[model samples]
Target: MAVARRRHREPHFVDVALRHRFLRHAHRDVQRRRIPLPIRHPGGPQVKLLYDWLTKEQGKDVVVTREPGGAPIAERIRHILLDPQNKGMDPKTEALLYAAGRAQHVSDTVRPALERDAVVICDRYIDSSLAYQGLARGLGEDDVLHLNEWATDELLPDLVILLHLEAERGLERLEGDPDRMESEDVSFHRKVGEAYVHLAREYPSRFAVVDASGTKEQVHTQVRAAVLPFLAPDRVET
Candidate 1:
C-alpha cells in the first residue's frame, strides 16, 4: 500500500509521462484497467497533480507515462513530431507518425505496466490524434481513429478525463513559446476544442469533461471528484 503525505497548499505541475490503468474490481480475478487523461486544450500539463494524488490515495503500484513518446523509440518520434522545423509536414504523415509512436508506446510501455496490475496514468491518447490531425488538420476523424485503433490493437481508455477550456483562453494562458502543436493558429485550436466535445458526446460512457477556466486548485478539485468513484473501496489494491 502507498503512504500518504501532508497536502501542500500550492501544487506544481510535473511534466512526466503518465498513463492510467486502474483496478476497479475487488476480485483479483478481474483483469487490470487503463484510463486516459486527455486535456482538450493544450496548455500547462495539469494532470500530474491527479497522478500524484492518486498515487498516495490509491495505495497501488502506479505508472506515469504519455503518448507520442513513452518508449525510447517513441521519444525520438515525439521529437520529430514536435520540432518547429518540421513545419509544413503533411497532415496524413503527421497522423501516421502519431499512430506509429503510440503503437510503440502501448506495446513497450502501457501494456507492460497494465499487465503488472499497475495503474497507468497516461497524459494523452488516441483522442489527441482524433482531434488534432483528424479534425484540425482536415483529415477524417473516422480514418484517423481507424488507423490508431489498428495501431494499438483497439486498447481503449476505461475512463477519459478531459480538461475543458476555450481554445483562445487556453492559448492566452500558455507561458513561453509554443511547440509545433501549440503553434497552430487559433482557428485550428477551436476545431480541436469542437472535436473534443464531439468525442465526449460520441463516447459518453467513458468521458468526463471538467471545465478548466478556474484556478489550478479548483480544476484539481473537480478532477478529484471525477476520479474518486473509480477508486471505490473495492477497487483499491490490497
Candidate 2:
C-alpha cells in the first residue's frame, strides 16, 4: 500500500496577522532598548500592559540573543558598504557578509515564523542585495542571482511586495532619518529603481508592484488589493 501524503492547508489572513503580531512582540521584546518596533494598530490597555511587561518584567540581565532582523541587516550592510576598510575588501567578501546576514535572519526569524504558519513581511530581502551590492561591485546579473540563491539557500518568498515609489518621493520620505544608505545619491536610487523594475519583469508571478507614491491609506489599499487573494476567500477571483 502507498503511504498517505498529508496536504498542508494555507493559513487564513487573520491567523497569519495574529501570528505576525506575536512575532513582532517577540522581536520588539528582544530590542526594546535600541529601537521600538511600530505597532500596526492600537490595541487594548491590556495589550499595552503586556508589551510593557514583556519589556520590563523580563530582567534586563536576561539576555535575548540577537537575531538577524531585516533592519539590523540593512544597517550592517550599509555600514560595511560605506566603510573605508571595505574599499580594499574583495567583492566576494562583500557578498559573503550579505549572504551571512540573510541566512542568519532567515534561520533565526523568517524560518521560525514560516514554520509557525505566519506571513513574513520583510523590509528588504535578496532582491535589494541583488540590486545594491550587485550594481555597486559591478557584478553581473547571473553572478548576483547565483550569490543570492546560495546565500538564501533557495528559500523564496511566496510574494514579493515592492513599494514602487518615485526616486524623489522615496528620498523625501527619508528626509527625517537620513541614514548613510538612505542619503545615497539620487542617481544611485534611480538605478536601484531600474533594477527593481527589471527584476519584476523577469519574475512577474512572484512580484507585486504597489504605488507607494500615495498616502499611507492609498498605499495600504493597493497592497491590500494585491494581497487579497491570499488573504481572504471572498477576495479571490474565480
Candidate 3:
C-alpha cells in the first residue's frame, strides 16, 4: 500500500528508493519539490527511519510506495525474485522479472498516485536492476535500462539520493540471515558499489551521494539538507 496526499496541479516530482545490498527499501512521492529523494544501496542501513521522518515532515496526505512489490501482483513477483529457495535463477530471467514487477507496480500504484497529484516515496527502482543485473549479473546496463524505461513508460526520477557505504561494511551491518541477493559473494556486491559510483558520476545532476557511515541522526540530517533545497517552503505545492 501507499501513503498519498492530494494536490491541485498535476504531480511532477521525483521518487525515493534505496537499494540495500540485499533489501531494497524505497518510496516515491510527487510534489512541487520535483526531485526524487535519496537512496542507499547494500551495506547501507535501512532507510525506514528516514521514510518515517519524511512522512511526518511532508504532512498528512503524502503517498509512500515501494518498487517491485508496491502492488499485489508486483509483490508476488518480488517474492519469486528474492526467495532464496529459488536458487540458480538465470541472471536475464531475474532482470526480466524485475521489469515485469515494475510494470505492474507502475500500473497499479505509482501512476495512479501521481495522477492524483500525490507525493510518492518509493523504496527501490531502476538503479537496483542497473547495478545488480546490469553490471554484477553481466546483463549489460543499456539493455536493462531500456527494458525498465519501457516498463515504466520512461518515467525517471529527478533526484536519486544514494546512501553510500562500503560493500564489506554494509555486509557486516546485516543482523540476521541474508537473503538471496545478500547471500551473494562479496565480489558481486563490490560490483554493485562500483556501479552505483559510476552512476553517480554519470548522472551528477540527478544523483546525491550521501555518506551512510555516520550515525542515524547525522545521516538523516544530510538527507534533509539534500532534500530541503528542492522542497523549499516557497516551492512546495499545496
Candidate 4:
C-alpha cells in the first residue's frame, strides 16, 4: 500500500494526475473482472483538483459540473460546508450536509458515469466526512458511521487511497493560503492524519497508504506502485 502525506498549502495538480491515473487503471481492472467499474472521488486536500482535471484533461463533455444551483445536489452541500457561517453548526448538521452531498454526487455524477462506462474520479467522498466531521468534529464513531450509512445507503469504496504525510511536512507544502478546514492548526491536522492511519489499520484490505513526503514525482511513483495491483491481474511489477 502507498501512503503519502499532504498539506493544505501545496499545489494539487500533481496529486490530481496521480489520482486520475489510479482511477483509469482501476476502472480497466474492474472491467477485466466483468464487474461494473467503480468511481473514484478524490477527497481531502485534492478536491479542487477534480474540477480542473475534469475540465482540462477529461474534457467537459465527459464530466458533469456541480456548480452552485446546478443539477448536482452535492454542490449545494459543498457550498454550505465551505461557507464561513457553517463554523458554528452542530456536528449532526454538518454530518447531514456531507451525507446530502454524497447522496447527490453518487446519484447524479457517479451513477451516470457507471451507465456510460466512464470512470468517475471524484474529488472527495464519504471518507472526508468520516475524518473531518466524525473524528475532527468530535462526533462519536457510531454517529459518524450511522450518518455515513444513511447518506450513501452503506455504499463504500472498493478501494480507499489515503495519502499519508507528516503534519509539519504537509503544512510546509501548503502555499500559505488555506481554506476553512485546511487553515486549521497543526494539532487538528495531526488528529486527521491519525484518524486516517487508524482507518488504514482497521481496513487493511480496502485501504492503501502512500508515502507523500517526497517530491511530486516521487510521491506519484509510490502512489502508482500502490495502485498497480488493482490495475491488472498480475501484481504491479514495481
Candidate 5:
C-alpha cells in the first residue's frame, strides 16, 4: 500500500488505507532503503543527530552509521585518516585511504544491513571525499569517482540529503581546535560548498538540498519532506 502525509485537503482514501495498512502491519512491511545525510555543512552533525531521533519517531526501521568508521576495519582506517598528526598526507593518498575505509564499510557493514532488508542511514559517504579532496584539494573529480566505484563496487545511496549553509557561518559553528579538513582555510570550505552544490545539480535525482541555517526542528522538517516522497511509493502531490 502507498502512503502519503495528510494535508489541508484531508487524507485521501488511498492515504487513509495505506496508513491503516501500515499501522496494522508496521513491523513486517519495512523495506530496505539507504538514506545518507551528507554532512557538507559544519552545523550538519547536529542535524544528523537530531535526524537519528527523528528516525525512531518515523518508525522506518532504519539503522544509522557513519562513514570511515562504521565497521571494525573501517574504524581503524578512520583513526589514521582523522589523526591531526597526519598533516602531511598527500591528496592522492587521502583519496585512496577514504576508498579503503569505504570498501570495508560497504562489504562488512552497509551491504550486509541492506541485504537483511534494513534501511541503512549513513552520516557521510563518497560525496564527502568528492567535496573535500576531489574538488577542494584538486584531486580531480573523475579520479575520485573512479576510486569510490572500485571501493563500493559502484554502490550508491538511495537518497543523499545535503545540509547546505554558507562556509563562514558553518565554520563559526565549530568548537575547539579544528581537525585537518576543518583546519583548511575559509576559501577551501567555500570551494567545498561549491563542490557540494555542483554535485546536487549534477545529480538532482539522488540529491536533496536542505537549508542548514535553520533551527534543528526546522531543518528536520525539511529533511523529512525531502525523503518522504521517495520513501512512500504513493503519489505525493507536494
Candidate 6:
C-alpha cells in the first residue's frame, strides 16, 4: 500500500548541550527541530517557559553552547562571517571560515566535553553548511560535508531536529534587519528551503523535521516528543 512519510535537518551557528547531559543529568544532546519564532513571538513566552521547565526537570544535565561564538576566538570569526558588510565574501571563503571556526570550537570546547563523556548539543552544525553553502550556494553537498568532516573529525550529531519553514515565512518571523544569510535574495532562500528538504530525506536517521508554523505549544509539543524519548527522563508532564 502506498503511503506518506517525511524527515528533516539544522542551520545557524553551532550550539548544543554537554555530551552526557541526557542520561547522566550532565551534558548535552542535539535536537533536530528548532522553533525560534515561538521563543520570540508575543505568545512565545509559553514556549520559553516550557523549555525552562523541561530543562529544570531534567536537572543540570545539559550545557548549551554555540559554535563560531562559543569560544572567544571562534566568536571573532563568527562576526567576520556574518557581518552584512561582508556580503562580498566569496562562497568558498565563507564555507572555509565556518569550518575554521568549528575546528577551533571543537578542539577547544566540543572534544573536551565529549572526552568527559558529556552529551554536547550544538544549535547549528555540519547540516547548516550542507544547506547553506552546499545547496544554496551551489557548493556541492559532498564538498561542504567533507570539509566539515575534517573540521570535526567526523563527529556526527546524535540527532538533528529541523524547524521546517518556508523561506518567506521564516523571514517574516524576524524582528530585526536580516543578517548576511537571511538578507539573501528570495530565490536564494527558496534554494535554502529546498536544500533543507533534500537533507531531511538524505539523512533520516538523525534528522526529524517539525512544522514551524504551528502555535508555540503545538511546535514545542513535537520537539519535546522527539527529544524526550532520548533523555528518558521522568518525563515533564507539560
- On TM-score, the leading prediction is 1
Q: Each prediction's Cα RMSD? A: 8.5, 11.7, 7.4, 10.1, 8.7, 8.8
Candidate 1, backbone clash total: 17
Report lDDT (CA) for all predictions: 0.71, 0.49, 0.67, 0.51, 0.67, 0.62
- lDDT of model number 6: 0.62
List candidate 2 stretches off by more than 4 Å: 1-68, 71-92, 175-177, 232-238
Clashes of each: 17, 0, 28, 23, 0, 32
lDDT of 2 by residue, 1-238 (tens): 0001212223311111211212221121231101111111111222233233333542111111121235466457647755654446676676667777777666666656555443344555666666666864467666876776666555544455577767777676552556445556888888878887787777675567766666565665665555544432332332
Ranking by lDDT: 1, 5, 3, 6, 4, 2
Q: lDDT by residue for model 1 over 1-238, one digit each (tens)? A: 1112111212211111123433332222333233445454542456567766767666667777887798999999999999999998999999999999999999999889876666766778988898888887889988998898788766666567788888899899887878898888898888999988897888776677899888888988887776665554455542
Query: Worst ten-residue run, lDDT, model 1?
Result: 7-16
Tell me the TM-score of model 4: 0.67
lDDT value, candidate 2, whole model: 0.49
* Model 2 / residue 35 / CA error / Å: 25
TM-score of each model, paired residue for residue: 0.82, 0.63, 0.79, 0.67, 0.78, 0.76
- The TM-score obtained by model 3 is 0.79
lDDT of predicted model 1: 0.71
lDDT string for model 5 (1-238, tens) is 1233322222111111211111211112322223344454754455455446545555444556787789999999998888889999998888899999999998898777655555566788988888888998898888998788667766655456788899999899888888776778899889999999998888776677889899877887776676565445544333
The segments of candidate 4 whose C-alpha lies over 4 angstroms from its true place after superposition are: 1-71, 233-238
Regions more than 4 Å wrong, model 3 = 1-37, 42-46, 235-238
Model 6, backbone clash pairs (residues 3+ apart or across chains), number = 32
Error of 1 at 57 (Å): 2.1
Q: How much is the lDDT of residue 223 in candidate 1? A: 73
Candidate 4 per-residue lDDT, tens place, 39-150, comes to: 1222233323433443454342234333121235666667777676556777778777777777676666655654554434444455667677788778866688777666
